[model samples]
Target: MYRERAIRLAGAVRWESVSAGDEPVRVLPDGCLDLLWSSGRGLLVAGPDRTAHLSVSAPGERWVGLRLPPGVGPAVFGVPADELRDRRVPLADLWGPTAVAVADRVADGRDVAAVLEEVARGRLVAAGGPDPLGAYLAGRLAAGGPVGAVAAEVGLGARALHRRCLRLFGYGPKTLARILRMRRALALARAGTPLAEVSAAAGYADQAHLTRDVRDLAGVPPGVLLRA
Candidate 1:
């Protein structure tokens, strides 16, 4: 497995990915936005204009995941998070011409960082926003840093914060928390920690709760992912 720092390219963004076997399975739930362009292998995607579930079962050894930063997604894909709920769009369609251009640039030996900066800036320029809520939620998600008290710290009532988050982040606060928590759990599991300890440390109610979350979000039992 590897973790590489990536920057957005001119007209697009990229994310660091960690993978396993030649044909590893990846399961992602509703939340986050991306525009992926792949040559081969198809995926099963669920959800609509707000949330989505994607399952990739592939025989190909190569997989790349691009995670669009909050506001930047709608600008690139023309499908704002506000418009996406349970819909699943293919990477080819989502990537459009921008993806092709970026790939060509990358292949031409241009600096990835410089290319990403140009891409990001171009999109930001096109997408004008008075997006206070989106800005607030992005900062909150970053600073929340794996805690349930993000709402309280922001001085928002739980219910109000929940609604605001839905509009801004395209997912409820609880769902975001579960996603973050499960992500941490997956890391701990991969690091060889015991399941019970991982569950407690990751703040799940119990091992069973952790298992369920993993199953739902990752489409695999905790045991299976850990061993991978």
Candidate 2:
């Protein structure tokens, strides 16, 4: 089973326990980064992805992860978001010996999710909190606001907005908007909405537009992803 919960920290926590017989998990792009710990892989960081990621695991493999909200990862992870884009790296590579200690604690049966949360909370505090403007921009884009309007609202020009997004979200505002729209469409479809309505409501030009975006970001058609 795969489950997720919104916690008091910066974002959501998810846990997945998979069996060898299960099909590969299709993870869609959500414009977020995850700090993940697996039974076999220890601790690793999953970067913001522009496309879907297929995850396969061994028999009885388990995973606990804390997903950081957009604009929060660079601050908490102490790295430029663009540097980690579309990549998964061992935490030790970024955090050094500190990451090793965290892995050891998880190996010793410490609550994996809780440990990740604690680490994130500490980093957030040290970083003097998340970027308020960046978070607001993320929210606006996710709500389907036009990038130009969002930039003007934030008192930043287009070029400045692009730079900020690259530093905070690992992509430009337009790409982030596309990712968010795709997520919105998927949520509506999964909730039993018709594809036509989903496409329109999620800001796509039409069903074909929705299909193309889904294929581009998720590596599959909407029907396949919805069925999965």
Best by TM-score: 2
- Residue lDDT tens for model 2, 62-107: 8888888888888888998989999999999999999988888877
RMSD of every candidate to native, in Å, equals: 5.6, 1.3
User: Poorest 10 consecutive residues of model 1 by lDDT?
Assistant: 43-52
Residue 97 lDDT in model 1? 71
* Candidate 1 structure lDDT: 0.56
Q: What is the C-alpha lDDT of each candidate?
A: 0.56, 0.87
- Residue 64, model 2, lDDT: 82
TM-score of each: 0.63, 0.95
* Per-residue alpha-carbon lDDT of candidate 1 for residues 144-216, written as tens digits (9 for 90 to 100): 3433567666778878877766655567776766665676777787788888998888877899999888887
